[model samples]
Target chain A: MTEKKTLKRFASVFLASSLIVGALAGCSSSEEGTTTTTSGGSSSGSSDSSEVIKIGANLELSGAVASYGSSIGKGAELAVEEINAAGGIDGKQIELVKVDNKSENSEATNAAIKLATQDKVTAMIAPATSGNVIATAQIANQYKIPTVTASGTAPNVTENEDGSINDYVFRTCFIDPFQGIVAANFATELGAKNVAIYADNSSDYAKGLAASFKQQIEANGGKVVAEEAYVAKDVDFKSTLTNLKSKNPEFIFIPGYYEEVGLIVKQARELGIDVPLMGADGWDSPTLVELAGKDALNNTFITNHYSSQDPEETIQGFVKAFEGKFNESPNAFHALGYDTVYFIADAIKRAGSTDGEAIQKALAETTDLSLITGTFSVDEKHNPVKSATVLEYVDGNQKFNSKVNP
Target chain B: MEWLQQLVNGISLGSIYALIALGYTMVYGIIKLINFAHGDVFMLGAFIGFYAIARWDIGFIPALIISMLLCAIIGVIIERVAYKRLRNATRIAALITAIGVSLLIEYTVIFFRGASPEAYPEVMANKSISIFGASISSQSIMILAVTIVLMILLQFIVHKTKIGKAMRAVSHDADAARLMGINVDNTISATFAIGSALAGAAGVIFGIYYTRIDPLMGVLPGLKAFVAAVLGGIGSIPGAMVGGLVLGVVETIVSAIGYSLWRDAAAFVILILILILKPSGIFGKNAREKV
Candidate 1:
């Protein structure tokens, strides 16, 4: 009985010590969390009288499209830091009220609500993808705030299916149909009359590109010999490639992300289908070269926001600044994101006030505003009328081919 | 000719499904537990092989052997830690725990290696061999050969070894086998080791075949392999092989006819049709409910 008592006492002592350590660990972690949130942005207490211009960034920071969202976030942060450092727009510091949408539509809506209603942000930068941007567009409009999407290329992001232009929804990049048209024109320029389209069935971005490419290619007197669709996460595209090979198209347009496109290119090449392949901004990832290999991606092209390799003075200067800030060269998404923030700041500076209505008018009237991606004016549909650079993948490197202007 | 090409593609893909199905079938046959984590084991195996080939620069055979051995050990540990105590409990409890383990493994992988996919280097020379107007890559042929060799080796161990005899006994009647001095726990662990080892091999070949490896890659393939095991008459050895081939061919054929959008749905459609038409499966014995 005496031994059992000793054992019970020891167990209680151990439990007490462990509980104390657990509490201490929890406290430190919470403190670290607070530090990160504070360092990242003023995620809390952005009231109207805060003497700072609150820019709501509803982005995909940690989900399926996290890479795009986080890249844009970094660019936006850098742009804000530069603007604040250069003496804030109209002498008021820009408080970026960043929020994560988890790459989900409903979460994006919730983020917009939290930013608009609680944080009371004046202008908002939308999600990177089209669907997430569309999901939050209605909320932004309801709040009378103009939102700029960095890379949401779908037409429906700025316009509804019924051909109604979203009054307050604006984007800093060209639409999906524009990318498809550029590829089609590029194909025609190469004198390829026979073309095939293998597009992703999962995303509106790919489907939109496919539809526009088909429309423009048929207009250019090229016949679409074979049209096929593949879902996301599919690895084996051999059977489809074999079927497509029989049709004998001279060029193939694949409007999809890097993940599936890379494997498709490799597999198609292995099957002796050596036609030139093309994709859009979705294929602008280093993962593409890794997956498709240098040889397989030899004859591919993609229409992008801007090429960092461009010798344009504005572009080179922007690239240098971005590389210095982020320790890496800026991709098309980063350029678009950086340009998006500058786009808003330019509008706010012209509007001469933090008022949403004034900023909306100034943004809609944005004309020939030179930014990192390009000098662009907002069209009636809120799409940026800018030049897209066609990048050819030669020896696994994206070589700037030519710039196409709409 | 195009049909022939599709058939080649189907067979190669089917062989992978067969390998993964073997694990599910064997684990269920021996323990009467649906090891949902079996698919995640396959994913882990691919990642292991990716590290083996990509990081360590190990040759194909050594990488294959190393991946199989490591996965076998992981399989045994999963069974010991998660499933062993629940062996006497309800089957539902063990199945849920298996699913939990599967999610844990996938997320743990995702936590370490970000969600981006890693491209597997071409370990084998990619050369096309045309037979009867149907072009087949040497990579596909190699994958088919490795799968066949593994299946044959699994057959040899299952039907010929002392451990194999012990497995058959315990699967038939665990209580009776335990009474006869058979170590049930060790036999079960061996079964997992063998099964997971095959899954590991499948993962490596899959990486070579598709050349893209990601953390969440196991979920869909796992569910499909389960469907394959069911179609093959769950718990039946030979049934899993035939079932996997049939499923692969049907999926490819569906995509070949321009219904590519319905390709993934085609697998589940077959599953439903089989369950309704042949609930006992193609090779399953019609054992009545004991209750």
Candidate 2:
């Protein structure tokens, strides 16, 4: 009887724990100081000389883009380490209240809100995907907190229908239009007259790149043989490939991340299609070479923020420091991270205070800031106006090919 | 031209699904429990193949065999550890346990491989030959050929061998088969091992053809193969093949004809319509519960 009762109790406890974990998985931000308190009272800032500036870093730390996010986080951490080592920023140490969003939008949005309201973080560097950026930007704006995204490249991340950008949000990376134009011009320069496109229909970034690439290709007198669309999670591409081959294009342009790009390149090659391939910054991972093999990517080209082979002092310094720290060369996304922190630091120094309005004003007026990405200047609408680099893989390493000023 | 193109795409994909469904059907034949983990076993097979290439720089043929052997071992282990102990449990209990085992394998993959999909190396991907205005790659031809050979080998084994009789007997009635001096447990394990090996083969082809592999890669295909198994008649071997091919072809045709978004939805819609109207699939025997 005792054993039966004990077994029943154990089952109930296990069931409760599973339910709690499920709920946590669904709304993970609550554990990160996001509480369910009603919005009647707000706390006032205390006048402490050694004040703590809690900031949130929500990212996809364990998914397909983990390497990108992990490197970005390391870059950000490097900034924090440098700042703190130099006796902190404004005599207040910056504490990163980090949360792994794990690529789930609901959890990301929840984390952003939690960081803003419950943790009452002074600022945030958010949920990295373009969709996550758009979603979290609204919450940050609603709560009146300053948030800057490092690498959400979709135009809608900043721009509104009326050619205005969101006031509260800023991004370090160039918009998709810039990347698309750069890719298109690069393709034209390569003398490719016929091209096929495979795009991720779900992501705003992929759709934007496809539209822009197609428009530019047509504008440049290049024929689009076929356009195929795929969802983010679908790994199989036999049908898409077969359908695409019916048109018989000379080159293929995939404007998604490295995950599908690597697979597409490999499968496309296996099918005896040895056409050159082109992509955007999302293909700048070392894993791409490892996954797709160097030979497969021999003729591939892409437009990126900065390459590991960049000879610029800041970039070389960043590469060395990053390698010394993490033991691997940082990619374009990681460069965005290093630039994001520096950009924010520049704004803080200009603002001379952590006041949100002052920081926003300083950020809007950013100009001639030498970043690892390149020289960045914030436009009137607060988008980064900077030249990007064209990179190609040679002998298994991404090398700087040329700079495009689109 | 478009319709013809759609048909070609569908037939090609359907063949791949048919290969995977055979694994699901054969395992369920003996144990009556869906090997939910079978799809992951296929994924494991692909990874094993990848490892062979990465670590050993092995040629395609050797990589293929090593990958199949790895999957077989994984299947046998799953049987010994999870399914064997649950044989006496209620059917629903076994089904749920299978699901748990499947999730465990998937998450374990995520934990190690991370969430990002890895691209298959290009030795197989970047080659194509145009035939009849349809582009077919050497990889596709290889996938089709391997699947055909596997089907023939399976047919031969199931119809011509003593173990085949043991499998049939156990699947038909475990108690009667035991009375007739057949080792029911061993037959069931052998069935799972073979079924898992086929899944492994399909998985390697899937990874090569898709050019990407992730932890949760198996769920949709696994579910689809299960649906195929039922569509062909739950316990029928050839029926699973037919069902998988039909499902694959229909999905491909749907996408090729420009309803790309609705392509996946079409598979389930057809499965549901078929089940509601004709519970006994095209090749399935009408199952009657013994009172």
Candidate 3:
């Protein structure tokens, strides 16, 4: 009887210790996870507004669109550095609270929530991609946080489906319709009568760009000979390219990201369809040239936000600074990132406060803002009324062709 | 003419499926476990080839050989570490372990190499040869030739060699074969090594053909190859080859007819229909469940 009582006492003690260990482990692991999530940003838990103003950067640091996210992050970093060096927005240094969305839409929303609630950020800079920005913008709106995107150019990003403006959502880049019209005008100028479009059906950005480009092409009196669609992450385009070859269109328009576009170009060329390929800002990555051989890029063109070859003084200065810092040429996404930071800072300066409502009003009233891309102002729908640059790749070099104004 | 062109495209794609299917079939024939991680092994093969070409600057043939050899070792290690322990466990246990290994390898690769798709460098001069108004690239021809050669070699090893006979004996009955002095464990390891080597070759060919490699690249191809293995009769060698070709052609023709969205769905639909119609598969033999 004494031995049994001792055994029961031992069992209870063991259970209590196990529970304590489990709780300790859970606490440490949760802490570790939060630390990793908040590691991308500089300041953490600075809710007391006096020391520094916390601005959240929700970007895609890893996944399919990681290249865009990384570049945009670097550009934002450069802008933050320059701003802080120049006595940061009314004597309060801006502290960027960055979070990687892992190139996922759902994660973007989560990142936004964490930034708004957990980090207590004053304003948030959203992701570059339209799909991700659209996903997170709703959360930002619900939280009444002024959210600005660097390059989410889809029309519905700043506007609702019923054509209502999103009060908290704003962008530093032009919309898809403007980019599509620019591409169509460029193609028409090249004397193309009929064109084929190979679009990514799964992506909102691709479908949006393709639809607008088609509308603009027909409006310009040019016929769309063949239209083909493929989902993202599809590596094989031989069958579709083969079918397109028989149609023998004058040119091909691929409005998708660089990863798919590069493979499509290579496959199209291999199939002996030698028509020039055109795309939108999605083809601004260096991987495009690497994937599609340098020789294959001779006749390719893209409607970009900024060309690294631009000789404008403001653009040149940004380019030189970006190259010196990142040791790589800045693409359109980089310019947009730089512009997004400066735009947000300008709004804060005008508002004279870091309050969400104040920033939103100041952002809506933004005018005559000179950015790396172009001098522009935020329109009624919170999209920039800026010009798009047409970049032509000749012999592997991306040369600035011309600018198209909205 | 369009049909003919799609047919060529199908053959090219089918050959890759076939190469991958051989590994699945052979591994399943020896062990009842569905080696779900076989696809990731193929993915590793592609990465090995990528490093071979980009980092080592080696020729295509040498890279192919190196990848195959390295994958064979990897397969053996995976079998020894993960499968060997579960050999006597329930079928469900082994199957679940396979899935776990698959996830482990995929995420491990993602952790080491970022999830972005890397461009596979052009290792060979690309030249297309037109036949009857349909174009076939030299890369396609090379893939087909290599698959055929590997299949022939596999057949020889399984049918004629001592190890092959021992493998067949072990597959018939592991305990009985061990009683008869055959090293069942060694035979199982050999089967895994051979199967993994074939997967490695398929990876290199796929990378060369697609010119894109990512951590998740093996998922779809692996599932399709599993379907191919099922369509051809899971335990049959010749069945896998024929099934892969048919699947490739059907997918190509479906896409050619402007139903590209249904391309992935078609493979699963075929799987369901085959399961409903011929559960034993085209080449699968109907056998009673042992007590």
Instruction: Provide the RMSD of all predictions against the true structure, rounded to 1 decimal.
Output: 5.7, 6.9, 7.1
User: How would you encode candidate 1's per-residue C-alpha lDDT over B61-92 as one tens digit per residue?
Assistant: 89899889978888887887678878889989
Which residue pairs clash in candidate 1? none
Candidate 1 CA-lDDT value: 0.87
Number of the top-ranking candidate, with lDDT as the measure: 1
Model 3 Cα lDDT, one tens digit per residue, B1-291: 767778888999999999999889989988888999899989988888888788779989999999899788878877876788788899999999789778877766665445667888999998988888877888888888888899899889989999999988988888899999999889999999999999999999999988888888999999999999999999888999998998998888778877887888999999999999997789999988899
lDDT of 3 by residue, A56-152 (tens): 9999887767767877788888998898888788878888878989889999999999999998888999998888998987888888899999888
lDDT agreement of model 2 with the native: 0.75
What are the DockQ scores of the candidates, in order? Answer: 0.42, 0.26, 0.31
lDDT tens per residue, model 1, A238-298: 8788889989999999999999999999999988899899999899989999999999999
Best by TM-score: 1
List TM-score per model, in order.
0.89, 0.80, 0.87
The window of 10 residues in a row where model 1 chain A has the poorest summed lDDT is A27-36
Lowest lDDT 10-mer window, candidate 3 chain A?
A27-36
RMSD to native, candidate 1? 5.7
- Winner on DockQ between 1 and 3 is 1
- Report lDDT (Cα) of residue B234, candidate 3: 91
Q: State the weakest 10-residue window (summed lDDT) of model 2 chain A.
A: A35-44
| Residue runs of model 1 more than 4 Å from their true location after superposition | A1-54, A80-122, B286-291
Q: DockQ winner among the candidates?
A: 1
